[model samples]
Target chain A: MSRQTPLNAAHRKLGARMVDFAGWDMPVQYTSVIAEHEAVRTAAGLFDVSHMGEIEFHGPGALAAVNGLLTNDLSRCADGQALYAGLLNDEGGFVDDVVAYRFSAERILVCVNASNREKDFAWMTARARGCTPVDRSDEFAQLALQGPKAAAILQRLTPVQLSGVGTYRFTEGAVAGVDCIIARTGYTGEDGFELYCAPVRAEALWNALLAAGAANGLKPAGLGARDSLRTEMKYALYGNDIDDAHTPLEAGLGWIVKLDKQDFVGKAALERQKAAGVPRRLVGFELTGAGIARHGYPVLKDGQRVGEVTSGTLGPSVKKAIGIGYVPAAHSAEGSTFDVEIRGRPVAARVVKTPFWKRG
Target chain B: MGNYPGSLKYTKDHEWARAEGSRYVIGITDHAQAELGEVVFVDLPEVGKQVTAGKPFGAAESTKAASDLFAPVTGKVVKANEALKADPSALNSDPYGAGWLVELEPTDGDTSHLMDADSYVKLLG
Candidate 1:
């Protein structure tokens, strides 16, 4: 049986179409995927991101233990700061991509993909030396309020001055009388806050936010809009885009990998790969003709299969079929043309610089 | 459960056939459209193309997944909905009306195979 989130009943009340997402019975869309997606880009939208896992680590050895496992350097991260990091296998391929929040010198919290929760906790626990890695997935309920007007809608509840919170910054405060860890972070390429609260208080907080934002046009978005919005921004979804078979470097996430850091899990393999040069590179493309290129669709160059699409959609904001995939390093440059085989038909497409839709 | 027009016939694959003299107006059932979410693209077979009963003639793509559109009866495609080619969301908004996929001139076929509205509703359960 698929697990249900704290707001599952609320979603059903709103007439959300539910789907089994990574073992969780989650809302895929409340209205339509395009409508919900456009709402996030234009005004504001809410998301029940409670399915995402939160793993905590605390102790004197927390920094050292976490720094050894992640590809990004945690030593430079100050309290109230968060940084995107990659957890890689010994062979330099990504096990999962995570957002590591530094609560203090001895405490840290990592938000991970829901599907990789158990596996990630076990992986980190086995490698941790002095610090204890705790699986706290069930303890927290996460909600995301995203878009240009997100702050205005959320400001009505919390006493904390949101203007002081910058991107990747967070603070502990009460929203609508419920204690929460309000963080300025989001998967969609929009300005937003992720509110992490106790599971028991989720329903109250959800209803309060909806009531407050109802006038400003904040609709309850679901996993469908979340996926499309992230795709438009070219953010890698752990399973579909980045997995054990692909390294962060090849996925165009080299900026997040700090090779200069000392003794991380995948450092050796990454160093060798960097020196040898990456054979393949992830690239973004837009369909020139017709049809959407879906995940696992064959990408062809000169009628020969060259790569495969990892993530794609007929982006609501962009109003075009766009996708990201891997190709030979030689053909990975912007403006290179390719054909994606959709339903046995080769539709012409061209490589383009991604984050297809950007807000002014 | 979604609305199933009593005047139409349904296939197990969730397509509906509305008899219009010699030609039948074909579209996906309301239940199928709801399950598919927002239809981003509706790829239909070209006009005059031969379609066999129970065979996939085209596909309907949503943000979540792609579902094949199966022919309800052996027929020759007389007209494909060109409007849906531009705006496929019609399938979600009005599956029984503007979302009609194709108009086909059906060949000699067994009428007993297709389920009526009551039977289709029962099968859905």
Candidate 2:
């Protein structure tokens, strides 16, 4: 049995095709994946991301404790700001990638991937000493309102002055009479706001946003559209792209790792690996042939297995089959040619620069 | 749920076949397209290729996944919807008419195992 989100009833009533995602009963699509994906790219799309987990830390040492456990330098973030970071094991491999929101000097909230919630909480609780670590997953419901018209649509309901939020910034205010933390963040590589509110008020917020965005062409998107939208931007999904066995360095997320910063988990291993040089690196590739490259498909170089696809999709915006996977650092260069084996047939492919779909 | 024409024979795999003399026009049901979301690509079997009943002859890939297209009757594929190669969205918009997959010259014209529209609608429930 899977857990249900606060908005589960609403999704079912809208005729969404439900699927078991990370042990949560989630909608894969309410209408069509392509239409929903295109809506987020062009106009706006509302997404119930309440399945994502929230872990909070509060105390005098919350900032330092959080900085010690994650890869990014949290000290650089001011109050009411959020930064993308990764939680890594001692071996530099990902425990889970998260967004740490700094609400105050002593209060921090980290949004984690749903599948890794329990494990991430346990890991953080043991390492983040001198601070209170609370698993507040059930307390909050998240909604991602994304696309070009997102701000215009959200502004219709909230008087928060969304433009002042800025990218990676958040503010607390009432949206549709419901208190929420409106953060200017999204996974779609589009301008958007992620609204976090109490679970009890999820449906009300969802309903209000939908009614507000209806005139602006807002569609109720699902996990299927989410996957395609994120893939077009080359954003790594937790279980598929990054996992306990793969490090941030190998996943092209080295920019998030602050080696010069003070001691942190995985610091020693990353430093040692940096000194020795990385053997493999992740690269984005596009299939030149007919078949779509799917996850777990082998990447071949001269009929020999060189790597395997981590995440893939027929990008709705780009209209091309694109994917990200790890290969030898030598073969990770842009324009490098390789073959992605689709059902035993090697389809020709070439590594390309990421962000396959750039907003015009 | 889409209207399953009473004139067509249906397969449990969601394919439908309409007989026209010795030839059968085959396409996936509206329910199939609805379940598959939007079709982005339709990998059709080449003309002159033999297809066995209940066996997959091609694939219809949507953004979410790729589902194999099964043949409802044994036949030699006489024609494939070439327009679908450029625009597969027709499968979602008009599954029964313009979205027809192939025209087959039946080697054994038997559709005894297939169901009618009423039976297909019952299966959907």
Q: Give the number of the best model, judged by DockQ.
A: 1
Residue A199's C-alpha lDDT in candidate 2? 94
Please, what are the lDDT tens digits per residue for candidate 1 over residues A118-207?
989989988777798999999999999999889999899999999999999999999999999999999999999999999999999999
Flag regions of model 2 displaced more than 4 Å: B20-23, B48-52, B73-76, B104-112
Minimal lDDT window, size 10, model 1 chain A: A351-360
TM-score of candidate 1 on Cα atoms, chains taken together: 0.97
Q: Model 2: what is its DockQ? A: 0.62
Residue A198 CA displacement from its true place in model 2, Å? 0.9
Chain A TM-score values, per prediction: 0.99, 0.99
Which interface RMSD does candidate 1 score?
Answer: 1.2
Model 1: how far residue A95 lies from native, Å: 0.7
DockQ agreement of candidate 1 with the native complex? 0.69
